[model samples]
Target: MPVPHERTSKKKFYRSPGGAARVTYIRGKSGRHHCAYCGGLLHGVPHSKGVAGTRALSRSQRRPSALFAGKLCTRCRATAVEEAAKVKSGFKAAEAVELSLKPFVLEAMARVE
Candidate 1:
């Protein structure tokens, strides 16, 4: 049996050159980051098995630098900006925005000039 920490890890079997069987444990890889609004995979985020692995990456390598970089995809960011503009211009009411998009729109509005 594997140690306590590796109990949940997957096992791989291999044959040694001396004709002995060996087992190795492998921890699972982390899933890719996803956009908060669109539920699509976010780019520029590192995939690592543990916190230590992630910490090894530099700040810029961990996530994008743009606004809502880790949370929203480019397309959704554009949509939020557009919705915010409409709300600010009186073309769309604050309460009229979809609930899923309301928070993002408001965030964009806050950052606008």
Candidate 2:
């Protein structure tokens, strides 16, 4: 890729009030996207593809494209998977505790009584 020539700013009027700054554009430059998880440059390539059939019976049951749809970048995604595996393997899955309004209702009933 060719480097763009150095840009020179235009002279501003002394008496005029400033509204917006001038926008500059290079001939061949385009916007680049970064990773969703790590905020690193994605460059030109996508996340890696793991060996086939590794997740054939996985509970998540999502396609590889769907799984990596968020563009997390391979390294960060790997680290996240490692952390999740550590948590999942070391501990049993806990049931979600439902929040109930029964306590508030009981308090109100007591106040009424």
Candidate 3:
């Protein structure tokens, strides 16, 4: 029987040289990170086995350096920047921005210019 920590792990059987079957437990992998805005898979992010494995990585390896890198995809980031620029320049109203994009647009507006 597996220990309490490994109770949920998958089991595999292998034949040994002595003709005895050996069982091995395999732990499940963590899910990939997705973008908050586009629901696309995030790039440049490592999927570690658990919290300790993730903590072992450097900050740069854990997430990208770009603004909102881990949270938003490149395409959505670009759109947010464009919308923020238009809103800042009086071409678009803040209220007219899409509900999902409003927070991103506001954040970009404050940071860009």
How does each model score on TM-score?
0.78, 0.33, 0.78
How would you encode candidate 1's per-residue C-alpha lDDT over 26-109 as one tens digit per residue? 877878888899999899887754788788888898888987888999899889999999999999999999999999999999
CA shift of 36, model 2, Å: 2.1
Q: Tell me, what's the RMSD of every candidate?
A: 3.2, 19.0, 3.4
Instruction: Residues 28-60, candidate 2: write the lDDT tens digits.
Output: 423455666567766443223233433454534
Better TM-score candidate (2, 3): 3
Please give the clash total of every predicted structure, in order.
0, 0, 0
Judging by lDDT against the true structure, name the best candidate.
3
lDDT of model 3 at position 103: 96
Ranking by lDDT: 3, 1, 2
CA lDDT, every prediction?
0.88, 0.42, 0.89
Candidate 3 per-residue lDDT, tens place, 32-55, comes to 989888899999988855889888
